[model samples]
Target chain A: MAESKKPDSSRRSERSRRAIYEAALALVGETGYARTTIEGIAARAGVGKQTIYRWWPSKAAVLLEAFLDVAEQAAQGEPLIPDTGDLEADLKLVMRATVDELNSPPYDAPARALAAESVVDPGLAAEFVGRLLEPQLQLYVHRLRSAQDAGHVRAGVDPRIALELLVGPLAHRWLLRTLPLTHAYADEVVEYALYGLAPRP
Target chain B: MAESKKPDSSRRSERSRRAIYEAALALVGETGYARTTIEGIAARAGVGKQTIYRWWPSKAAVLLEAFLDVAEQAAQGEPLIPDTGDLEADLKLVMRATVDELNSPPYDAPARALAAESVVDPGLAAEFVGRLLEPQLQLYVHRLRSAQDAGHVRAGVDPRIALELLVGPLAHRWLLRTLPLTHAYADEVVEYALYGLAPRP
Candidate 1:
């Protein structure tokens, strides 16, 4: 198994895969999801049409993989919510980083385009949820469950639903553009979510 | 000064306006936002294209007005958050109603279509937010501010941000199909929001 023959073939395959991902991302960003096609991606990537088909069953699959690659690259920092033994600090840090991703250069167009498409198209939406969104959400579920065990979160709280209190507000701000998604806004969301809006007993 | 206007003219105009709104809604639901043209709406509604132009400047304006009319009709019995002076009850009431609307038959298709388009198109999204979303959100802001005055919500809480804590999780659940939005979930969201996620002090 170790002596798999040629290194050049593997190098060439990796390069082709990267090119395809780049092409898929760029095309979807530029032309919107409905207009992006396998042939077009192949042409843009300088790969044959058959090469794309050989890997992905459909355009949705191609774009889903491309988006995953983009997200992995963008998520360069370690897992977003770090447990520094202080739940509040860890939550704020994670929320702020998420705010930065929403507001900044790395994820604006491609994410917006894909999210928009998913809203109208249920089949595509399912694929998106299955491939990308759920995995990221599961990370938060794991973190929140840990916090609950530590007595930082209430014992009865459902970690899955509770995690949304942290993530959803940020997403709502980003998607609706109801207000500026600043670090300040992110801090406010974290504070309000951790310590309830109602007065302390 | 009482001026006498013909009842026939007013009645005819009302009929035409209703027809146009219905046509626009049905068209947008069947065809996605991009393909819904003013001419197509007029054709479907049995009104002249000039009539639609006379009332609204663009297809966006027509759809905006049409969707608002639909929401207004859907919200006819929609209870405003009942402030039995209990902020928690009021917030839970409004959110539970919202979950019903999001799950309802009338709102699902057209609302989803508009939201999908708004994601990719910022200008349209702004209009959708301004004309449709912001005013509805302001109702919550108004209610929350009242609660702050009554000492239910903390005085320093920004009502707009606080409202997101209530709205965001529900929207997230509905949009992502993450979990069933039920009475129990609604109550939990309100409870967790009113009391801190950390054990109560």
Candidate 2:
């Protein structure tokens, strides 16, 4: 509210905000969550400590906001997956984008760090799941519900749990770093998940 | 090899071995993997540092062995899932055991700690997937293959990938602590994976 009143300083404030977000992401990636501090972020961003404090409450808040900013940027003003009326194709498009985003370095390092840290820190993990992840997942649920209405999906199957079949394998592979995640793999996941892994008699 | 030659001292060695395993698991659970050291484990175990060295090469090795011991003990001489020839029933039986084991405290804390660390450490994660996790996964593959042979599963489905559909969701939920892992949930995973989310013609 205070920032909007001073129109002249808005651009400079925006620049500082972006710098702080970038700085927080970089520092968290380099130092890991336990060691990354608000002071370090401030110094890296070339901003004063009070500037950081004026906006965010704690280091977790900064990192979470930084990640949220990165995610929003990744979306490029489109918050929801494109509903092309074809669930499989639409899913493939979004999953492909996800595969591409994960492949990119700008988001990978910080996202991976945050994910690793979240595993140990339950409070941060809850925030991450509730705020950052579950919203995206709910979008998938919406898409699946549309599919159910279209008779593409089995009506009895719960959209929420069914969605995990698509996501769980991808997430499992990503978190464990067990295998290479490719666009082809994403397509396969979409296919296998939607078409069924069993022999269709 | 060398220890087995001296059969006379085997009883005392067994006691120290059990104590060290317990100490390693406890310390890692309490302080996490990075802070855990051979000296600390030895001190906690009431054994000398040399004793740990004689048995395991590094902290990772100790934790790996400790986890393996816990897993083996959890099975209580029943290591492999029963090949009851009924694929669905067999999978449920095993997955239910997994749900119970994860919910129980004896192994939960240390296993969670190890999994958290493994996410950040690629080499250890690879070894974990290859040496420890894959062998167990391959057992699923074997069972799935038998199911395929019996015409219970679609022969075209890759048993390796199919197994992940069952294992991945459970692991994802367990790792994230997103929800209560129950026998019912495990049963659902087996059903959904086998039958899939698409309409069955």
Compose the digit string of candidate 2's lDDT tens values, residues B45-98. 999999999988888898898889988888889857898888889999999998
**What ranges in model 2 sit over 4 Å off?**
A1-6, B1-8
Would you list the clashing residue pairs of candidate 1?
none
Proportion of native contacts found in each model?
Answer: 0.69, 0.56
TM-score attained by model 2 = 0.94
Model 2 per-residue lDDT tens digits across residues A130-198? 888888889989989988999889988888888788778878888887778888888877777877656
Number of colliding residue pairs in model 1: 0
lDDT of each structure? 0.85, 0.85
* Residue-by-residue lDDT tens digits, candidate 1, B1-201: 132464877778888999999999888888889999999999999999999999998999998999999878877865566667898888888888888888885677778788878877889989999999999898889998888998988878999998898888887777666668888888888888777688776
Q: How does the DockQ of candidate 1 come out?
A: 0.72
Model 2 chain B TM at: 0.94
User: Clashing pairs in model 2?
Assistant: none
What TM-score against the true chain A does chain A of each candidate get? 0.93, 0.94
